[model samples]
Target: MPETARIRNVAVVGHRGTGKTSLVEALLFQSGAINRLGAVEAGTTISDADEDEHKRQLSIALSLTHATWQERKLNLVDIPGDPSFQGELRTAARVVEGLLVTVSGVMGVEVGTSRAWRLGDELGLARVVFVNMLDRERADFFRTLEQLRSQLSPQCVAVHIPIGTEHELTGIVDVLHMCAYASPEGAKEGEPGPIPDDIADIAAEYREKLLDAVVETDEALMERYLEGQELDAHEVAAALKAAVTKGEVFPVACGVATKNLGTHAVLDLLVEGVPSPAKKGSPIDVDGASTAVFVFKTVADPFAGRINLFRVLKGRVTAETTLVNLRGKGKERLGSLLELQGKEHKPALDYAEGDIGGVAKLKEAQTGDLLVDKEVAIEVPDFGFPEPVMSFAITPKTKGDEEKVATSIRRLAEEDQTLHLRRDQQTGEEILSGMSQMHVEVALERAKRRFGVDIELHPPRVPYRETIRREARAHGRYKKQTGGRGQFGDCHIVVSPFEEGEYEFVDKIVGGVIPQSYRPAVNKGIQEAMHHGELAGAPVQGVRVQLVDGSYHTVDSSEMAFKIAGSMAWKDAYMNADPVLLEPIMELEASVPDDVV
Candidate 1:
């Protein structure tokens, strides 16, 4: 296990088309973790392995991959950009202390960029921006830098500037050090060189901008610099790191992830500017001597059981370690831990404190589970997943495949907290809820492909209800005489709209007109009637039924008879009370471009 301070957990996140996964491949290639680089369009990126991800050419889930940079381990969590997958971002934030937010050099700050920035702000994570796709058409580093300053934060400062623009892009200039690096396509390392004569003035201009922001972290350095003294490069670099860790400044770097341009600088930035997990501190309060691990993500593998990915919060974890789950209170024996590089699992020797690793076949563990030493007792806060924004009714293709369909979807929901599966009692239809339409569709597709269960999806039932609009009265009398004993029940009820709440029953009957025992039976009968409304067979809502007066025979007025009388009285009054149908109405706010209007 490496030193805890040498481990840096960073999540790579950005909008779609910003080349986040491509940049991860470049970092992996530059660090020699992988000999070849993979493109997402070709379905070869390490971050995206699911079949649907390949079909859509998008990242659907978070992927964990580590790169060895400058004798340090960089745990790079590649996250999806789509809004539906924001749950993955929250999961990554809990374990990582730094966020490497990718931005398109062409489009600049977009919806995902803003969202990622706001998340980092909320979590107090140090953020670094990478302007990717610098070699694409209409790509402008300076323009994007301005956008970052205006849209994200005025504290945004450029540390690395592109040497060229668009198709002629070649390398980047390290503005802080007044140095240049020339890294062309397929270059593993940026060749150190002098600043080009053509862009020397511009590089100097950015260096001053970098210094102006960096010097504020140290008053003495700022005073000396203000006195016209040249600050030491090392001193400035140290201050920059502190400022970034404190979120006083957000340093921006430029790159074309596809061509591996400017990737080394980003890796160097991660090693230098980002704080280690040990320095950032853990979210869980654990005893110093005991080991603790928080399971942030789970993969439901039908063949391999559950693969749990966790961050070591306290002590080290090895092959012989036994952990007790805080939530389930079950002792889980040690299993061979593995490192998840995309879908490939490599044997991991051990996990040091604050390091993340995956283990398979735990007896009983799920996402958000805190597993620790038996002696250590602590409470783990949940991930607090966002509610699903969309829902669909699901029906299995085969008549008897209901259990299989529900079981598969529930298993997937365990892995994806944003995907929720439930059964509607009113309609008796299985409903699947998710962050978006694509989120639900992808889950259903995965269920069919992996679990061998197919289901049809459509709009969920409206869950409408029925409520009365006016007041009406009716009398119900039941008298059946056939032999020595006869059945007799009489009751008068007034049905009126109760706008405040659902189904209020009042007994205004005085004296022995309706017996006390039979009164409860009448209320029970009215409650049953509330389940099926008179209009559209929907559930009844917001109506009050009152038993004002009635007469009952001494022998024949049993609870059953009174119950039947109450049922009859409710139906008669409901029909004359002018029942109305009610439906759920959704309130939404949308943002549209000006031209669309």
Candidate 2:
């Protein structure tokens, strides 16, 4: 594994179609990491290599890749921008030190922009918003900057201004150095050139604005600038980086990712401008003790079993180490370490602070489990998952498929945190739920692809409760005659509502009318019978049954005979008890669009 100091872990976040994945490809291409860039529509991009992602034309999971720039190793994570895949975004946040938020110059200040801003704020990550898509029509850098100021935050300031408008984007003005960088392909370290003739005045104006934003971070710089003293480029860069990493100032840069414009320059800015993990705050924790690693995703394979992806927070982890699972409570051994590159895994032995990696199947370890060193037990807080809002009932097609359905559902749930599968206790139906209808459909697709389990989905049944409205009495008798022996039992039961909310069973027999041993058998039968109501086959609730009187034959009576008698009595009494079905009304507190509400 690589040391933390040599590693640059940064997350590329932005709205959909802002060219985040394309920027990643460009970075890889220029860094000599990959020979050629793959297109998103072709479903051959390195980051979006997953089959499900390719079919959907979007990233469903965080894609982890690495590249090297100027002797420094960069760990790049490209995250999905869609809300349904926010799980991937959260995973990326746990592993990176700085955020590179991409914004489309054509569509400024979008919903994705607002979301990424708030996410970075919540994680306390240093931010640098790259305004991309400069060559497209209606792509106004200045207008986009104004929109960012109005909708996002006023702390944003331009550090680099484009040289010209659309179709004429040949270079950019460096505000700090008072220099112009021209690129035929818009890459960094291109042949140095004099400031372009047309945009020199505009560059001069923004350079002062850039200097003003930097000077506020240091009193000496502020005084020097206010007194008309000129500061050098090196001094300016240092102050600007400090302010940006400290969340005082957010410097915006512009480029066209698809045309390979300004990508290398953006890479340089990330390496030089972003903060290192050591300078960042300590890792996240739950209690007073330092945090242990918690995995948010696991991929099950027929050959590999399970590949668990996780982030190391407070401590170092190596192969063959044992950890106590605060959730699973069993000791888990760290298997072979893995660094994910596209869909492949590169072998490693250990990982350090703020590093993201994976390990082969850890028996008994699961997502949301805090893997402690066992000697020093500490628990990390679990990651939050949105509640599943949509549901469907799934049934298998083939004979003897009922048991396979449960196993397949569990495996699918293990893979997707957003998916939930459980038996509806009230309705007695197996329900699979997720964020939306499409989410559940994707889960079904994965089930067929990964687990080879085919299922038919139907609307989930509505769960209802059943209760009795009046009291009733029932007497039941059970007798079995055989050649050698006989069985006889009798019981009288009184059924009524128990305060209209509680379900209880009481034995009030006196004078040894029925043996104490037989009383439990009667209660068991009533409890078992309560599982299915007489109406609509729903579970019965809010009622109590009492065993009042009964007689038993000394030699012939048995527990089975008493149970049968009690079950019969309950069924007979239930019809006359005035049972009614009660529909469940969910008291929902939701924050939706005002028009919908």
Candidate 3:
């Protein structure tokens, strides 16, 4: 097991089209994890290995990949920037202690930037900003830096400045080292050199600002700086890590990710500035010192039953380590403990405390489930999912494939907590819901591709109900004299709004006006009328029907005649009583940053 100081679990988050994945690729390539860099346009990147992602050209799910920088393992979880896939974003936030927030150099501080920053604040996560895509048209690093300061936080200080503008961009100025690091087009890493004269003065200014921010986090450093004593890079870096972990400072780095410019500088900052899990992770009870794994994400693999990616919260876990699932209280052996490189699984020795790892084929382990050793006990953290915003009714395209469709939906929902399958009580249709319409569509598409079950999406039918407003009375006389033993029935009824309940029928008959045996027929008829209301043909609600005075032929007043009379009378009274239609409403609360709005 690696010491807690060597492990750094970070989530790469930003808006769509901000080169989050591209930056991750550059980092991996610079660290020698991959020999070649893969472009997102070609869909050859390891992080985005799914076919659906290739088709959409956007991340619909989070991907886990790691790189080694100076013998320190950096577990990089690349999360989708799109708001529609916020579920994945939240999932990544739950397990990681730091965030590598990517900002588009051209677009500056966008909606996604604000959202990610606020999320970091919400979780008290240490944040590092990368101003990516500086090689694109109209990309400005200084302007984006100002936006980061004004929009995100005043503590957003730059540790590096870009060497050139769009198209002419070649390198970055490492403000902390007071030097320049340039990378030629297609280079794997940037080499440090003397800072350009044109940007030297500006780099010094940013360096001074960085020192100012870093020293404030440490009283001793501040006092030393106040006494005119110079602080070296190492002193500032150590203080910067504490500041970043406490969210008192945010260090900004610049890069053209596709060209791999400033890749090594970013990695160096990540290792030097980001906090180890021990500083940022939740405090653990030393008395309950035993292995515990918190499963944060689960991927449903066809060949492998379930791939649960977990964070070792308390102690180390390795292959064949049997742990008790907190949910099911069942023993689950770590059969295939592996570290993930996107879809590829590499065998892992063990995941130390606060380190993330994957284990395939746990019996009932799932997202948000904590598995602890039998000797250890802990409460599972609640990583609540976003309520599905859009819903649609889905049915199997082919008949008698209901079981297959339902099974596919169930399995899909298991993998994605945001995807939901529910049956509408009023419409009697299977409803599929997700964060957005596209979210639902992509899940359904995956169900088709993975489970071999095809389903058709229909607009979710509105569960409208019906009710009466006013009190009204009516009479119905059904008299048929054909030949012998004809049908003769007479009844009166009043339909009114029932304040307390959904539906009620009262028989107010006296002196055998309507026979006792046939009175139940009156109630049955009114109930049948309640099923189909008068307004939109929906089920009537909060209706009270009263069977008042009525005459019936002793011989021909059978249950059938009275039933028809009651039905006719109730229909007339319902129409006379002001009827209204009601639809179900959902109350949703959204936590959106003002800048994003």
C-alpha lDDT score of every prediction, in listed order:
0.87, 0.78, 0.84
Compared with the true structure, what per-residue lDDT tens digits does model 1 show for residues 1-597? 688999999999999779999999999999998998899989988888878889999999899999899999989999999988889988888899899999999888888888788888888999999999988899999999988897889899999998888989878899988888886686687567899999999999999999999998789899999999988889999999899888899999987888888888888888888899878888677764378889999886555568898999988998788988878789986576887787678778799998988988887788888888874557667676778889899999989999999889888877899998888999998889999999998998989888899899988879998888899999888888888888888999999998645678899988988889889988887788778987798888898888999999987778888888888898899999999888787777664323236
- Candidates' TM-scores? 0.94, 0.77, 0.86
Per TM-score, what order, best first?
A: 1, 3, 2
On residues 1-597, what C-alpha lDDT tens digit does candidate 2 reach at each position? Answer: 666666677888988778888888778877778777677788877888667888888877777777888777787889887766666676667667788888988988777777778778887888888898888889999999987777777788997888777887877777777777765462434655688777888889999888888899989899999899889888989898788778888889887766566666677777766676656744465344353676756776455578887777656788866777777678888867787776667778888766677888788766666676644545454456657777899888776787887887788677677778888876668899886777777777777887678888999888877889999999989999886678877999999987655788888998898998888888877778878888977778898898899999998888888988888899899989999998876566643322225
RMSD of each: 2.5, 5.5, 4.2
**Which is better, 2 or 3, measured by TM-score?**
3
Candidate scoring better on lDDT of 1 and 2: 1
Backbone collision tally, model 1: 0
lDDT of 3 by residue, 544-597 (tens): 888888898977778988888888898888889988888877997765545558
Residue 390, model 2: lDDT of 78
* Rank order (by lDDT, best first): 1, 3, 2
* Cα lDDT, model 1, residue 581: 88
Clashes of 3: 1
Q: What value does the lDDT take at residue 447 in candidate 2?
A: 75
